[model samples]
Target: MPDNRERDRKDHYLPRGFLKGFIDPANKDLAKPLWHFDLETTAWSRESPGSIGWERGMYDYHPGTNVLEHPDEVFERFEREFPLVREYLLRRNFKGWVKQHKHFLLEFAQMMRARSPLFLQQQTAQNENTRIMTVTSVGPGNQVGVDTTVPYPPPARFIRNRTITAMREEIKKGPDWMENFHWCLRYTRSVADPFVTGTQPIVVEGRYPNSNDAPVLEDALNDHNTIIWFPLCWQACLVGAVDRFDEGTAEAPPSLISHVRGMFRRPSAGYVISPIKIESF
Candidate 1:
């Protein structure tokens, strides 16, 4: 008989299996039609010539070359004028003293790029049958289910899902797939504020397969399945957990949660993380 333990060890690192959970039929609501949302921003800058303005139409910020003169007013205007951008900035604590710092605006732009459909759509377009969906909102404070004094704003919450077929094709390109996926995740982390973590607005209902229960790479490839789900903000936690596991340090990392037997589970259904680190760099 095949040793299920050995199979799990090998399948744990297979990206295909991980991707399948996102597009499973059971997750259709979370995988709502990609065309429902309109991401177009207003060109708020065009009307205000020679003044630092926000292009509400195109969702671009015009610095007017001297944005430092009135940092507070500039940011305040952003908050009052551009609701979406304001929500994202507030989550990162971009106000008062923080507004004076260099790289504030640049960081805002980077955050928008990471949260926007621009990059995902570009990547998905490369594949013939792939599509991308991005949902953005400012979360309600009470809605997060975590006790905190701070109010969660809309536009700060972003969920991105891309057709898994694109990811599979990239995986077929040999080891490059690993690099590409890791790079994408890291880039996202770098651009986002540390406080900005993913939220599970849509609950996926299904049985999450354990690492040992994952399908083999060959089977996963032939299955032609896809997965779509929110990207959780457990990268740091994951790294910490894996590090402790690898070094055999004292107990499991505190970040490790929802453990069932050999696999570590996420709050979202059908997503599992193996104890060992699956990708590097």
Candidate 2:
């Protein structure tokens, strides 16, 4: 029999079992199709021409065992933003800090990557049979409504009966699939501010753009089968309840909610740490 870790890990990967039910069927049954983008295939740069002084690649971390490995490359940009943040540690005076907080920091990075479809989509693999659904907001600004839907199907049915349970089952099948199936959904009103920042009210494209095709919000919300309802139940495991709600945010320490909004921004350059609260059935 599998222990809780094994059982929980299993639930984390497969998209058809627990995940299917975990995401509300009505939400999943929408008409919107999923959108997938290949980060390696596209050219990514800072979203703004003059946006400066912040970490360049802080938002690109992926979850799983390899989560720590990305710090070296991404941290370079972080150092550029805050030299003292890293310099103080290089002296090794904070070995105790490293010991106690290293894992927490890594987990935080994973949450950042997990929250962004830009990063999350990059981590996903192609499966013609498995339908992909994208979950993101709609409209000119972040005020846009949250919608769901299925994506254009592949040549075959690699996946069936999509759900959070099934998504978790798929992840446990192998270690490499860790970052593909899950996401952090932290939707809040204040976080929507950036999405609707400009005054002209330009027709905003979908938050996530895929290499294959850009599926707009209206298209995504229509197909529920492809949609995976944001799973709130899963958030606690990645981020503790206290830090997630109180201290982490665009303001007030910024919670995962703020990060999720940042990741969904148009031409998002960096990543934000969003709290993923997966809803339980």
Candidate 3:
């Protein structure tokens, strides 16, 4: 059998199995008619979960060996437990949930943030610094001296490794801080305008745009003022608000869908994923 590193050459940041839930319910074809909209290009296309939202060896820490790092091992576990979350979303159950369940849900949301390309770029910029070296050469006697300077950028691998290390640390702490927040499972009454997700799926409402660093995210998670929205599937969305209570199984109004659809444009996401074809989100 192939080892973990070789199991998936194309690693999906957003779990492939999880995206399958967004497929159109009416489409009985095996093609899995999932709609993809490009926010930048204003173009749309049909796709399957396995064909999109993946990169070549994004999680392969080691290429020539069987060694797999924290991301692969950790993410695999989350995807495995996705079915349980799916069941929960399907039944719309709001009871019997323990702290661990809530914890994993929080961690999974953080992982989605960390795994995003934009987030990775932000983390890389935060971790890497340029090195400048200056050399002064003295000429014979009182001759003029020349100053030579060279700049060396940090290696891509070095920056990525450091970012990954920090990502591991942050992913662990994010969920813990936000565990006490009121979580609501909101569902759409119609599949016509199901919930939409994207490359940067987790939206931190009312927070500064592109301020998704660990410190900022942790602050948002801990702060009762910030609201977080996570699209679980076409029909369901997971919401976090510290002040709101008595939020049980409730119908997600069309106005709410319009609100989320409006959000996909801000900060400019790479892709907008949904069950129905959205002409212009």
Candidate 4:
């Protein structure tokens, strides 16, 4: 029988770099085992009626509880309520609409940012043993892509399109946009697969501690204390462990494909070391 000391040694025998960089010195007991999740950008599907028309106005009226007013009726109501405002909206195009609804638009964006982390916390509470670290993109791929056959709902559709485009542009210019932008992008996609195992997170390669995308990696490390970063292409998987504030580093673990190949080669193999829990992302 394996002794307690032997068991301890086997369990704690992670790569040296992984331990020094990721594991919190204060919590050397490995209180929460680190898990990684990947993010992917997907085009919007137009086939489903529920998926279409995600404008602010869509939530204002329910098909069951209220009659869906025609666009002209809605516009007439808006004009009646604020006659002077109608002229401004007509003259400035989308700029006037943005000015009028700036607060609501910002709030919508903020809500999108908050949803994922809250969901993740809820999931974690349900199962404390599994730590889910989500990875998403904040670069160019954050723009909306659609694959729909139905015609958009006129003015509402235009408003939604303009609002999203403006929001994306604003996010691109902001300093800490990546953190919030990624979540917002995911909310827009509204796909079932949370982990996005098939898609790879964007990797910005350069200098060790001072790369352009370093903050993004650092932020993830700080949040979860460890990350399993699977880059796209044929790049090796990176196991990042966080040691302290902005003091995390990564090590290349054996590729999953290679590990599987070795397993197939030796079916009678008693044991195989893996960098992460192989069951899920």
Candidate 5:
């Protein structure tokens, strides 16, 4: 066998910029490692039956699940029951969402307090719940596209209609909504996939060592409603958001197609060899 000194060297095992170097070389192919998920949402699409609006007022009530609604006589007896009535009304709405998707409802309930206060008190209090609901659809298509058929609006395009519309309206009158309004999901997939490969926990050391630098990294990837399997071979895979493409800088918001193409490039594996003036034995 040829002498294995080169292979056994510390530099060989702990290559300089190992993760970054590896990904840099094989980025072309590795970038294309399937980064989308197709969500299946036919069962939990419609409004739940136990909905309690003015017309629909708690019909089919279960023991532990249902909130108690006092009768007209009872309401009149206790003049202070209006507060309870309001609480019950709001609780019913919150619990109704839980009846549909229990898992997410739990997560949303836990994070309910940490949300920012909005204009609509009743709705804003449950905005985290709304986010959980909204993200359910957006989460799937996060990296690739939130593939769905709810018929009202597609989640990927929904952001444009919802968030962008608000921003544009604010921008027309020259408001500082950009700070308040942010693109919810940027350079990250909310859904989890199992088959496809992706990167994780990537830490980039900015070129300017002492500058206020933030190196972005791939956060999540999904495929077929499962977290994609990112083969450990892929390294230093990062995600960045740019406002414009071909702007001769990295600050432009890379479009979906460009971002996808950037992730899935060829020569996505192996090493780079620089010509050195070492004398071979």
Candidate 6:
């Protein structure tokens, strides 16, 4: 085994710079706190960006004594360019995306899907839920025969091994949205109903014909009706849908924010993040 000593222990799924967008505008303090509703405790608390959203050694895979494959650096690089994307988003300058900016934004979206606790939970659950069966029969000539069927869900060790090396491959291929959909940036002007996010920052739902249903993850992917919402900060969100990709600034319709807020209460995530204390939720 490779030496695992002296490694970076804090694996922050939600990087601080990305979460910084949700800081309340009224509080201009450098050490501003974010309000979070703990799903596990069923209580609210305040925390800094660096203190929350991390698990110990989630991504510390070692193949050599001194070498480390850090998504850490790539995450920081993506966040460094985030402000520019946010600037263009808030300004509704959708055309401002040069090749590099577009690349960063799309890849960040893919990372948001891959580099979260929710992703791990989903992949692990899919594997563990896999079922196998065995059948036994008696031969006419007093010989016994048996058959076994193994399903496609990979073993847990295989999953972990792939996760360590797959980040770059996934980044290179990018997300389905990058290839197929146009994008939208949504800005909510109301302070009372600012956008809220979660540990699993990327949330998805179906629309129109299937609005009442949540989209299935795979197997005939419901991408055509799926709508995704990613909270960029307290004021803005990035949205993508099959039908429309235009950006806009508007107050979320009366029932909309409440519905979206409910969607962020993912079972896998321990908490929900907001810019300010929200008693109503």
Query: Which sections of candidate 1 miss by over 4 Å?
Result: 1-122, 125-166, 174-251, 255-281
Predicted candidate 6 versus true structure: per-residue lDDT over 1-281, tens digit per residue: 45355456888888887777777767547564788889887789888888888998776654343334456655666767777777666676444543435556767888776777766655455546665444477778976654555545555555555565465445556665454655666566776788888878877776443332322344223467777777777776667666654334344564777667777764533789888888875
lDDT tens readout by residue for model 3, 159-178: 66667666666665667656
C-alpha RMSD for every candidate: 25.0, 22.5, 6.9, 26.6, 28.8, 6.9
Residue 167 displacement in candidate 1 (angstroms): 3.6
List, in order, the clash count of every candidate structure: 25, 75, 0, 4, 30, 0
Candidate 5 wrongly placed segments (more than 4 Å): 1-183, 186-257, 260-281
User: Residue 206: error of model 2 in Å?
Assistant: 27
- Please provide, for model 5 over 50-148, each residue's C-alpha lDDT reduced to its tens digit, 9 standing for 90 to 100: 210112221111222322331222223222332343234234532332234333222221111111011112222232233312333334457433334
Candidate 4 lDDT over 83-180, as tens digits, reads: 24323433553243433643333332222222222222332333433323323434576854443444333343333333333333333342233333
Off by over 4 Å in 3: 1-8, 62-70, 92-100, 130-154, 212-225
Q: State TM-scores per candidate.
A: 0.16, 0.20, 0.78, 0.20, 0.14, 0.73
For candidate 2, write residues 1-281 as lDDT tens digits: 11112111211111122122122222345332111121234322222211211233223322221222222333243224322332343244334433444343333333322323332233243333355554466666655443445455542222211222233333233323222323222222232221111101111223334411332234433332222222221121122211123322112223533343333343423221111221210
lDDT for predicted candidate 5 compared with the true structure: 0.22
| Candidate 2 Cα lDDT to native | 0.27
Supply candidate 4's per-residue lDDT for 198: 19
TM-score of 1: 0.16
- CA shift at 144, candidate 6, in angstroms? 29
